[model samples]
Target: MHTYLGTFIGVLMVLTLQRVKIGPWGGTGGHAWDEGGHGASAGGYTGVRRMSIGSSWCVSSMLFEYDDNGKRVKGTLQGERDNGIPEEELDFHGEVLTHMCGYHDNHLIRWLQFRSNRNRTFGPYGNLGEDKAGWTRFEVSMEHSGSIVGFCGRSGNFTDAIGVYVAVWNPERFYDSMRRQGVRVYRASPLRMDLRQIEEEKKKEEVERGRLQKEIKEGRERLLKLRLKLGVDVLQQYQEIVQQLERGREGKRQTIEELQVEHEQLERERGRLRKELDLKRLRESRLEVELNHMQTWWSKITHL
Candidate 1:
């Protein structure tokens, strides 16, 4: 009988696990809703509740139906919670029970949280301890009857926590609904990361980098050519300057030679002027002597 019941519980656990599809068994961060009843009515469920969402089964709330022998008979799943709620609600909210977080896909990305009374800070199946308030809850297992259900143990717990619970919604149904609503779900397997896409991306980046390097080399060559041309022009300008200086020096030498010739001609003219002055003086003296002799002869004749 124990074996049959254990088999039954195993089947139920498998079903619940399939419904919640978080990576393993771990609790997501919990969100405690406002007890004042704002977020509770947003989704048409009364009484604000806390929720935890993650990629593992630990954050999902599990539901079980048990037999009279305290054995689990059946199972159901809830959904995954989101981070949309404020941080103040994190401690009180428990793991969500929903199908949205199951199936390991993003189509149904919603999470689940426990729904209970205002002052009931305990989680699903009384897994809460006295000091476990205000913490995210994770449901490990559950033994259930018609009305009273108790979980095996709390997987995630917090000390001095205000409110917390374990909760989960069915993920398969939520994913179906999302598909009906035209939401696309990528089937990317977390187990197998695609290396092809990564390689393609690397190749593209390499091509682009190669192109950039080629452009840089071409630019450097062009700049070198321009510099060489500028140097050639500077050398030509220096040559022209040297030629002009040489011509200027030659002109100065020619002017100095012409000045020397003028000096010689002026000296010859000065010598000729001195000779003419001497001749004039000689003629004047001879005329004076002849006049004196003529006056003396005229006197003698008169005396006779």
Candidate 2:
């Protein structure tokens, strides 16, 4: 009977280990920014509660769920900003949370805090201590003016400070949601950071790096092709302009030659006219002298 009982206990332990999820476990506590001055309440459930104060720019909501054993199994945090908070302000909010509650070590706590008021504070025990086991998975989403632009998820062992899986979407949304909302989204392969997992991650990283490098090289090649095409077009245009200039110069030269010919013809005509006028003047003077001689001869004959 004792052997049977021992066997049962061993089996039970194995089952428990299998059922328990391993990862950073923590909770957050705060007030809702839009709750009309009311502080955050868990609604009778034990988990993190995020809230905000002062303005709608800091509105947020969070939920945490635990199993019957009081172990945190799931958590969700959502932050919404509609008043156009600056990136620096967002970063400062995160920094303040880290400084005040050390949430970076365990993002679960950070998620709990999300975008609460600057004066709000949180801790793992204060929010999640009731749970027998800490959080095994975390999901976060942030929105701007009713547009869901950011999302993230993490799960795994916290021994190496890296989760088994991680994902991020539109991380730049917080910086300037008006311009950079939903522009950048990426997912990181689950990382355990164990010796084998690390090696696998390294291999994956190398492959990703190679892929990125190839893409960059291809982009550069495309750019070069475009530039070369543009250069060719520019050269063609320049050659056409030069040809037009040359044609204009040729036309001007032809016009100048024609003008010169016309000028020479005019000069020749002027010389001939001048010669005719001089001959006419000589003839008139001869006629005048003849007339005067005839008159004198008539006077002499009459006197005789």
Candidate 3:
């Protein structure tokens, strides 16, 4: 009987893994960030309740607000701002975030799109990167009756990378799975660092340290040989010119994006106003006809 019901749950309804983790997809330029916790309890449904994103030409920042087993969890903003772009808030209300897809340049996330359980599509938010050929697309989603609960990634001045944690959302299945197997649901916590994961992380850190050391060694060797080639003042002047050019280019791009967002808002306002004007004209026509009818009745009474 137990085997039969387990099979039924697996085949017909939600087959949930303890944790179905996807990726930290994006650039390698920033500090690693984790807002990962999928509310991995078999007692209740858990999912992202809302989200906010700040973007311009690139994704600047993101945050997730989660409802984890009746408790509210608000995640910190994941990245720094590159522009003065306003943040866009997406209030899911009660709907679950089911799917996410985005594109990333080698250095930063460029575009983001989202779909909810209500069949609503949120964005193709940022523009495609200038080098369209170099961008890579990625997707993370909940399988079966599930929900995406958390996010993790790398980010610097902009959102450099992104990822998600998925959990089964069927409240009935949670207790049934636990009771049938006497199995403990897997839980992920930043506080709980296992030894194998720690060792792997240490190895990565060592490799990065070695790479930086090698680069420094090579730079020193080159410097020793070509130390006298350029005067310090001349080098400073060159660097200043490069910085100026970079700042100017970046400033211009941001200005254009700001104007575009503002213009779109204005267009929507204009459409709303036009509809209101049409409604007002119809009301006036109706009122004018009623006035004529009253005047005609008054003349008949006076003639009598």
Task: Give a tens-digit lDDT track for model 3, residues 230-256.
Answer: 566679989999999999999999999
Model 1 Cα lDDT, one tens digit per residue, 16-109: 3121111232233333111111111111121112332232322333323322222223322233333442221311112212221112112121
Model 1 / residue 215 / CA error / Å: 2.7
Candidate No. with top lDDT: 3
Task: Sort the predicted structures by TM-score, highest score first.
Answer: 3, 2, 1
RMSD per prediction, one decimal? 18.8, 20.7, 41.6
Candidate 1 segments whose C-alpha is farther than 4 A from its true place: 1-206, 282-304
lDDT at position 126, candidate 3: 75
Deviating ranges (above 4 Å) for candidate 2:
1-193
Model 2 scores what on Cα lDDT? Answer: 0.36
Residue 242 Cα positional deviation in candidate 1, in Å, after optimal superposition: 2.5
Query: What's the CA error at residue 272 for candidate 1, in Å?
Result: 2.9
- The Cα local distance difference test for each model comes to 0.35, 0.36, 0.66
